[model samples]
Target chain A: EAGVVQSPRYKIIEKKQPVAFWCNPISGHNTLYWYRQNLGQGPELLIRYENEEAVDDSQLPKDRFSAERLKGVDSTLKIQPAELGDSAVYLCASSGGFGETQYFGPGTRLLVL
Target chain B: QQQVKQSPQSLIVQKGGISIINCAYENTAFDYFPWYQQFPGKGPALLIAIRPDVSEKKEGRFTISFNKSAKQFSLHIMDSQPGDSATYFCAASVGGYNKLIFGAGTRLAVHP
Candidate 1:
């Protein structure tokens, strides 16, 4: 079975510019998640979606970051007016069901200058 | 608040030796614990997992030892090989929430 798929494996943008990352979850998976991993650190949950509804997004920075799972299958995470500190690997994962083992995507590495 | 804490930011073990990484969680509600291994430029993949009800679970050369009372758990890689070298992360979650709180991770290097 194909795992999760993400677009733009690497991205470099200047500070204050807008950046967006896309993710296509595993087929038939009901749970989709977005995580950010900094250098030498574990992945940190940014948002989680159950179907098309976002159940957990408390960690997302509302001021500049926003995410949406339009059809419950694909998701997009956006950071407007990005900052240098936003540089990190953005990972997308999906599971067959809630709380199940998740399969991850190749992640988009974002470098904000 | 970093619910889970992992030890030994980095470890170097000789081939055929045992490598152990430890983690502790603060949330008693966490019932499921999982370990993920990741190599450079790749996403993490699940290695092994354990529930609170069981004290131990073993899969091949990988073993997970859980201490319910202590709110701690550990991963033991027996007969470690260079191929086993990777960054290991411990994570915990409760109920049907897909949100997993992860530790700071431990990097293991097995020298042959």
Candidate 2:
């Protein structure tokens, strides 16, 4: 089966601009996750959805970051008026079910100048 | 308490030698521990995992040694090869799979 897929593997934007990243989970997967990885750091959770319901999103920066999984298959993470510090990699992952191993996408590398 | 601390921010090993990366967690509620490997421009992929019940788990050239009492875990790469050079992350989560807390990561370089 194909693994999780993400779009726009790389993106460059200026500070104060809006950016969005897309993700397509594996077939039949029921859980999806969004994470951000800063340079030289591990990926950190931003949001999590279980069949369209966001079960965990406490780590998300509500002031500028938002995510949506309308159909429970694909997801979008958006950053409005992104800051210079927002430059990093955005990753998406999916799992078969609760407590299942998560498979990650290649991720979108964003550079904010 | 949710943080996973990893040591040796960077490691260098010769091919055919062993590579080791260690991690520790403060959250006793975390029952699941997993390791991920990532190459340049690629996403992280699962390498191996273990629970508190098992002290050690091995898969081919990779092994995870868990020290529950010490709240520490280490990944051992046997017969390291140049191809094995990559960034490795250790993570922990409650139950099995939930909100994962990942360590800063260890960049391993295996010179051939």
Q: Write the per-residue lDDT of candidate 2 for residues A12-60, one digit (tens) a residue.
A: 9999999999999999999999999999999999999999999999999
- Classify candidate 2 by CAPRI docking class: high
Predictions in order: lDDT: 0.93, 0.95
Top DockQ model:
2
Q: Flag regions of model 2 displaced more than 4 Å.
A: none
The candidates' DockQ values read: 0.73, 0.91
| Chain A (alone) TM-scores for all candidate structures | 0.98, 0.98
Q: Model 1 segments beyond 4 Å from truth?
A: none
Candidate 1 per-residue lDDT over residues B86-110, each given as its tens digit = 9999999887336888899999999
Q: After superposition, how far is residue A36 of candidate 2 from its true place, in Å?
A: 0.3
